[model samples]
Each structure stands twice: as structure tokens, then as C-alpha cells.
Target chain A: MYSSVSKGFALLVLVLMNCIMFSAKAANGITVSTEINFSAQPQQCVTLHQGRDCFATILIQWQRPTSQTICLFHVNKKQATSKKQLMCWPESKAGQANIEFESSDNLTYQLRTQLDDRLLAETEIIVSWLHKNTRRRRWRLF
Target chain B: MFTKPINPNIINRLFIYSIVAIAFFIAATTHASPEEQSLTTHGNTPITKDAFEWQFMLDMALVNSPVMLTDVEQTELWDYVQLGLLFDISYKGFFLRTNSRRSSTILGGEELGYQITVQKDWQLDVILKAYIEGFDPIEILDDQNKDIPELVGLNNREYTSGIALRYSRYFENAIFYIDIASARASENEQGHSATGIIIDSFYSYLIPYRNWDIYLGAGLTYYEKALMDYYIGINADEVSSARPFHIADSTFRAQLEVYAQYPLSQSWSFNAGITQSFYSNSIKRSPIIDKNKLTQLMVGVLYVF
Candidate 1:
């Protein structure tokens, strides 16, 4: 009986030690994981004229490990506004998320992602306006 | 009636004399005007210009004043040394700028620095900075008041030197600017060094009604360490020893700041700013000693000639 009692106490101590070790490991664990993948389209060319507006759709793809939610945020220079959305579990897929932005002269766009207020990734895009066809022809002749 | 008829010539003579007397009185009054008009002709004209076309301003203000150190959490009370020089050329919107400062005892040792920038309607500014800093050790001997024997001296010496490039645009009453630059620094004894890239952009709006201007800005900084041994790599046998310094080996920093400037006169202005930094890597992981995550407050005066 005494042997069984001692064995039970030893098992309890072992479980406690394991619990402490796991917590410590979690606290100090430094892992480098790629959190977000972002891509945009036309995927190539966008054209607009000075004093006119144009639009393009941006597609973003993000992957989070295990159980985590990703928040995507975007800003446009020409429109001077920001948009954000949440990707929850089960519905989040490995595909392009569509976004739209208006183009002005020398328009630019920046996008970033966050998970629970922690920034994961960021990138920038630029768009320029094209001159009219007649103007282009005149310049070519000159 | 008969006596009066005989005196018509005399009456005409009296009327003529009266007319001459009136004309003399009018001429005398006009010629002898008040002394006020006479003084105006001889007195000095308004002093529109001075002998020296350009003036130099030398100013010294005790920075510990409450107005200068408004935010307690961001600002620490320490001895501050500031020096500045500005030259205004004859051409409009052309100037030369030089500024330097030294602040002591906040983190330990001193930060000595100088920068030169050119001023135009739009500023194309270039800045250079050099600093020698020493970190205080955590454990000090009671008798000697020196660092503990186990600590390495390489952890104390941090020398940083860098150049910055900035472009600015000025509006009628406001200014906007963007800056991008890179810096490299190393410690000789440890063979440890870091190279960093920084990009900052900001806008300042003039609030003329209160004689002050407000500024808002955001900045991003990236740092990568070329040598890891100086930061966190430990000797094979010293596994249990704690690394007293926490340096971010490779990290990203983002910050937002607000600032205000008030002009005291044409030659003197007061400036202040509060900045908060967000870190990607832990501050305790840095190789440098006693570095922590905190907001910073800076306030100083600008003297323009």
C-alpha cells in the first residue's frame, strides 16, 4: 500500500514538472513563420489620364498556422481612405481576395496585414497616368 | 448829408486801407505754421534696414522648464547641451543650417552630434551624425563602484555614425517632407555590427491663430545584425549564465509622432515633439545594455538669421 501511495505522489510531481517545462518552452519559443502572401492584378498594366479616375482590383492571399485569424488592411493614396476585413476560421481559403481602388495622377497603394494587433506583413504598389493618344503622337513626331 | 457828400474820396481811401490790412493778416498766418510740421521735415525716416543684412542669433534656454518638458513619461530630466547656427543669404529662401546637441545621463554616457542642411523654398537636406555611448552595468561592486568582473567590456562600447537624406516641400503656410536613409555602426572589440535602413514621412500644418504649428508623422525602420556573437551567441560552457543585454538581432520599428512649433520672433522659435515606437522584436533581446521600449520627447529652440 505504501509503495502505491509513493508511486502516486511521484506521478503527480512528474506531471507538474512537465506542465512547467511546457509553459517555459512556449514562452521562449522563437519561430519564423511566413504569415501573409499578397498579390494584386490587373496583374500587369493600368492606364488612366490626368484629371480622370480609373479603377483596379487587388487580390490578397494569406495563410495562418493552426487556429488564427488574419486581418487585412489596405490604403490608397488617390482616394485617401482605408479598408479592413477579417478572415475567420473554416471560411479562409488559399485564393485571391478582391479589392478595388481608384487611380489618379501618380496614384499609389500600400497594403498590410495583422493578427491580433500584431503586424505580419506589408507591401506597396504604384500607378502612373498616361497621356492622351494625340499628345503621344505629337511627342513621337517631335 | 452835405458834409458826407464832400468826403467820398476819404471813404474810398479808408476802404482800400482795410482791404490791404486783411491781405497782410492772411499771408502772415500762412507763413508762420505750427512747429509740429517743421519737426516732421527734419526728423528721421523709419528705420527699414539695418547695417548688417544678416543677423546671427545665439540662444540658451534651461530645458528643464515645465513648458519644455510637458510629457513626463516621454521626457527625462537631464543636462542638455544645444548649439545651432543659421545664415540667411541675400537671395529669397536660401539659407545654410548647422545644429548640434549633447544629452547626458538618461541611458548613461553622452550623445554628441552635429548636422548641416540647406534651406530653400523646398529643402534638400543632408545630415551626418556620430555618437559614442557606454552602457552602465547592472551589478556594481560596493567598494570600487565598478562593473562586475563577469561582464564583457564589448557590451559597453557602442559607436554609431550615419548620414541621412531628406526632401521637403513647403506650402503657403505648411510643410511636408519625406526622408529615407541608411546607417552602419560597429564595436571594434567584439566584431559586432549592425546596418539599418530607415524611412520617415511627415506633414506639418501651420496654425497661425495660436502662433503655433502642428505636425503628424509616421516612420518605419529596419535593422539587421551582421555579427550575431556580440548580441546573443554564448560560449559553449556558459550555458546557465544570463545575457544581461537584450539586443534585437533583426527587427522592424514603426512609430507615430506629433509636434508643435511656436515662433517667439523673427529670429527665435520653440519646437517640441512626442514620439512612440512600436517594436517587432523584444527590447530585452538587444545586445546593448539597459535598453527599453519607451516613448521619447524632444524640445528645443531654433534660431534663424
Candidate 2:
């Protein structure tokens, strides 16, 4: 019984270890071939403080579309109201855009390959007004 | 105007146990927002019963004093982290994945289990896993409380695979849970070659206010003879002048817990819990055992992405 249990435990631990290791090291390797980095500053809000303006600064960045001009679409998921607008066409291989919303909600953005609105890549960021706990601290006595 | 008052009886019990002892011992750790998942919704339905949903929780607790003092007993505080991940895929009431969702209040144990939900009422779980000792005897560096004779003869524990069955349910204002497990001894480990059984059950009520949330609970634990000896027994060879041979039989443990979380923002919250556990005479009689009751507390922040 002991031997069998030991073997089983070892096997189970091995499987869990594999899951953890793979999850840590898998698909995160993004190729330079395609990418879109979208982020928002003040990603969240918790107070009526932080200066009354409770909104987030949205950023949309992607590799410049080589074949044609690309347009950007901001999909508001909070209220289900999505809008499309021309962002940037590739004058160069790299492109960047910064936009801000005065409200707080979840937002998604898509980059299109051409003015015809061929979708290429999409990303999202959320700006919230919920109260947030403070950051944690770690110290070592030894 | 929203106000939720904690039951007076619970407050009295919390006071009786001096649960506020760890109220000031806050640690710097963070759990994400979903940890506040006191509400579960299915499809387009309004707030309904708790169902298996996608959940990711990371809970960290800094215990000020080590309770299970089996090894290197000089440590003043210990850190514990419990991570849970559950993803459910279902369509038309048929769950494609094993509903692996549970509320975590037990110290720490791993269960490779599957759940069966009963009409969104009771949840049952069956688990099979390689067994490891639940009692942890840690080794701390630069030890301070070294030379304590009662901390001697502490050996690494042995374990084998085990089977556990758990049942739990969420009520209107409280959650009820229970679990039982039987263990098989590892063949190579000598003192632990006996089979054992354990039973535990708890009930906790939730009180939600505008910004504060409280969970008060109480529970009982029973360790069968084989299980008690595996953990609390002292071998003849390990017996010394300071540590005598101690044999244990079935034992019982009673526990009271109070946990609270204050959300400062939608993304950040402060969480804390104090648990006091009392042991039976069988365990308290061990020569190496010094405390009959142990109290642990943890307070930290939470960050949700």
C-alpha cells in the first residue's frame, strides 16, 4: 500500500508540476511578427479623490500595417456601445496612438489592416472606480 | 442607507476567543478581486445560487506564530499561500468540465477532485491524491528559540495516497461544508504504515455592508485513531529524556474563525482572518505538545487585474 501510494503521489506531483511549469512557460512567447500593446493609466479608481477626474488614458500601439492604411476601433464593452474611427495608416513600420476617456468602464480596441476595415488584432483594458487595497510589502529577517 | 449588523451571538463568541489578537498583525499580501465572489450568476439570470464559475484566487496569510510546532520551533511567524484555479465550460446545463470550484477556509490541503452539483443546491466532491502530512514542521534560519527540549525528536512526516469526499452548499446567508478523508501509509516510511481517517465540518455566515464584509464560522474535526498516531505519536526509538513515548487514539478539535475583508477600491481590498483551534486531550497529552489551543491570524491587501 505504501509503495503504491508513494508511486501515485509522485505521479500526481509530477503532473501538477508539469501543469505549473507549462502554464508558466507556454504561449507567452510572443513573436515579433505580430503584436498590439494596449494599456490604460490609472487602470483603476477607488476614491472620489484622485482629483475628481475618474477616467483612464487609453493607448493603442501596433506594428504598422505594411500593405495599407489601418483604422482603429474602440469597442466599449461596459455599455455595449462600440465605435470605429480611422487611427493611423503606416507611413512607417511602427505606429502609436494615445486616447483618453472621461468615464470609467471596460474598453476594447481593434486595429484594422486597411481603410476597408479588415480587422488585424485586438486588445482591451479596464478603468474602474472601485476601491482598491493597498500594495503589499515583503521583508526578510535573515 | 445600507447596514448589516453581525449577529450578537457571533460577536460574543468572537470576543470570547479574543479573535482581535491578530487584528493589528497585518501582513503585506494581495489577493485579486474575484476573491470577493460572494455572488454567482448563471447566464442571463439575476443573482442566484452559487454555481461553478471561472475562478482564480490567490490567498496569502502571514501566521504570527507557528501552531504545529513539530520542527525547528524558533520561528515567530510563518507564511502560507493558497492558490485556486477553476474553469468551467458548460452548455445547456451540461457541464463539459469537472466543476472544480470551492470556498477555501481549511488551512491547506491539495485535492485532485471532481464535483457533482445537485440542482444548484448541494455539491459533492470525490478526490484521490498522493498523501502528504497536513501538519507542517518548518525550518527557519537564524533561529532564536532553539534549545527548547520539548521541540526535540521531531522527524519528517510520512504519507501515502488518500481518498476524500466533500459536500458543501451555499445558503441564503451562510455556507455549510464538510469533508472526510482516509489515508494509506507509505510503505517505505516506518512509523506511518497504518491507515487513518479524518472528518471535518464547518458553517459560516456572511454579512455584507456597504464597504465591509464579515464571515463568522465554527467547526469540529475528528481524527481517528490511526490518523492521530501517525501525526501525534512518538516512536520508542525517538523517545528521549525530554521526549517520552506518547501514544494517541481518536481525538477531536474544535475551531472558531472570523474573517473580514474591506474593499478600498474595485481593484484593491484588505482581508483578514483569525482562527482559534482547540485540541483534544489525546493530542494535548503528548510530551512534545505544549499548546492545547492555537490561534492564527492573517491580514493583507488584494489586487485584481
Listed in order, each prediction's TM-score against the native is: 0.37, 0.50
User: Which ten residues in a row are the worst by lDDT in model 2 chain A?
Assistant: A133-142
Badly placed stretches (over 4 Å) of model 1 are A1-142, B1-127, B130-154, B169-176, B194-196, B200-203, B227-240, B244-247, B265-270, B287-292, B298-305
Tell me the tens digit of each residue's lDDT in model 2 across A27-91: 32211223333223333333221122344445545564454566677777656656656467554
Q: What does candidate 2's lDDT look like per residue over B124-173, in tens digits? A: 66655433333322222224345645545455344444677868776766
Q: Give the range where candidate 2 chain B is weakest over 10 consecutive residues by summed lDDT.
A: B1-10
State the lDDT at B198 in candidate 2: 68
Native-structure RMSD, model 1: 36.1
> Candidate 1, after superposition: displacement of residue B267 in Å?
4.7
Error of 2 at A45 (Å): 8.0
Candidate 1 clash pair list? B246-B284, B246-B285, B246-B286, B247-B285, B247-B286, B247-B287, B248-B286
10 residues in a row with least lDDT, candidate 1 chain B: B65-74
At residue A121, what lDDT does model 2 achieve?
57
lDDT by residue (tens digit), candidate 1, B1-305: 00010112333433543343334334434553322121111334321111112223343433321111001111322223333232211111121221212221111111111212223355455644332222222211222234434343323224444556767676754556555656555554445566565454555444432234465655555544432233333333323234332333555556666666555533356767676656554544433322333455556775533
For candidate 1, lDDT tens digit of each residue in A9-101? 654564455455444322212111365443444332233222334455655555545344445555454565544443333435343466665
